[model samples]
Target: MPDSSTHPTISSAFPLNVLIQGEGFPILCLHGHPGSGRSMSVFTNALSLRFKTLAPDLRGYGRSQTVQNFEMPDHLIDLEALLDRHQIDQCLILGWSLGGILALELALRQLKRVSGLILVATAARPWGNHPPVTWQDNLYTGLASVFNRLNPGWRWNIDTFGQRSLYRYLIQQHTPETYQYLAREAMDAYLQTSRQATQALYKALNQGYNRLADLPKIQCPCLVLAGAGDRHITPASSQETADHLPNAEWRCYPNTAHLFPWEMPNQVLKDICDWIERNPEVISFKKPEVRSRGQ
Candidate 1:
């Protein structure tokens, strides 16, 4: 639960449902594809000791209203509305997986509004460098598309057993029970959406999204964090992105995969706060110290 009295907010005009916490240095937290604000809420809550956190469901995911088109620009428009609503001038952005790409784009589009960036499991450009899309990816999406064509209602089904199963496979956590707990939390959070919507978001974000040339154009400092075991977006991608950035640092957690928010919340918060401390331009003043059960 959020400590902020006015949190778990849903904007009437824009309909971007958000969970706001902490009191200083607003940091926007954007969750990955097929994920909702609750996906990152755990990590954001951990950071409440240091920086203020704003975790919002991307358009069409979680409690936010479904968008006609789930494109990168559509997501950005919602983010702009968030900034305007909060009256925040510029703050750091912490993006996880797909959220990393959005944070990079936000910094690229509005450099002044983005003071710093923390990209976890993100890429720079030429997502083509990864091996060709897996057959599993194709099969799941193809089946969903086929089902939706046959029955439009199938596209909006909330039973995300398949999605959660795939996530368990991707997130190589400690135990099956722990993974199940994490997956169930996310499944409950991802209400009112479908696999077709997931495919649409992946397509929109991946299409023509080569930003190698634009990486150098970013004026703010950046930190790229990756998981050694994340096959979806590997460590090499994070390294390539960090290499292209003028002021950036790259780090990878051993034996960890994607979904670091759930797998390694403490480490994630520590690195993020450390990066902000190095920049010193962000709002949080004290060095962030977070403790984890196993860490």
Candidate 2:
């Protein structure tokens, strides 16, 4: 349950939904697709021990309002507002899944506001295309289509089977309200992103300006976290992203899935904390020149 003693506040910058705690330089937590910030609580709670953490439900997820006309750039605008609201000029950013896209975008564009970056199980490539020779894509698409028809205007309760089943047990740990909030926000994210975001993403597929190509442009020291058993995003994909970056380090957690942050929070936090310690200057100071993608 959320701390009722401390009221939840809303921001007008995409009206970001946020959870703040701890002490030290700020660290913004961005969750992946069909995900709310709450999903990464396992990672956030531990990170809070070393740094002030702010986990925001990305635009269109959780309490954040969806933009009527959305675009890739909206993500940056929302993060900008968050930094301004928190009076944080610069901070470390950690993103998982779809949140990793936003993290990369912010690091590339608003480099001045971000210091170090941690990308968990995310690829530099636009993940809009169906995987070649894999029935998984067809299965997921077919299921999504069926769910879309069954639950019109409902975001969370549509498909309670396939993908939902994978995380059901973990979700059971949360309070009823928290679970409901997560469910509703997931539905909203699916609905809001399925059209504009998804189309724009596919359009970018095969283009040279993808996550992989953009890595060398990021001057900040990055920690690329990947799971060995991430079937959706093969281990090779993680290695490829690491290979392109100028100064990126990688750590693989054995026997883990795409949800490594939640599944193995301690290791994830240690990796991030260790990286920040080794590169202390990367945080708590201005290093805009570092992020220029000078190619």
lDDT of 2 at 262: 51
The segments of candidate 2 whose C-alpha lies over 4 angstroms from its true place after superposition are 1-13, 126-209, 287-295
Cα lDDT of model 1 by residue, 1-295, tens digit: 0111222223433458998988878889998767877778666877766778899987777788564654455577678779888988788898987788888877877777788888988886524233455777666644533443344323142133324234433555544333443545554455545454576666765565567767887867888898877777778878899999999989988867776555676777777777777888755333436888899
Clashing pairs in 1: none
Best by TM-score: 1
Which parts of model 1 have CA positions greater than 4 angstroms off?
1-13, 126-169, 176-181, 190-196, 284-295
lDDT of candidate model 1 versus the reference: 0.69
TM-score of each: 0.74, 0.69
Worst 10 residues of 1 by lDDT: 1-10
Expressed as tens digits, the lDDT of each residue in 16-53 for candidate 2 is: 78999889888888887667677667677787887788
- Give the alpha-carbon lDDT of every model: 0.69, 0.65
lDDT of 1 at 6: 24
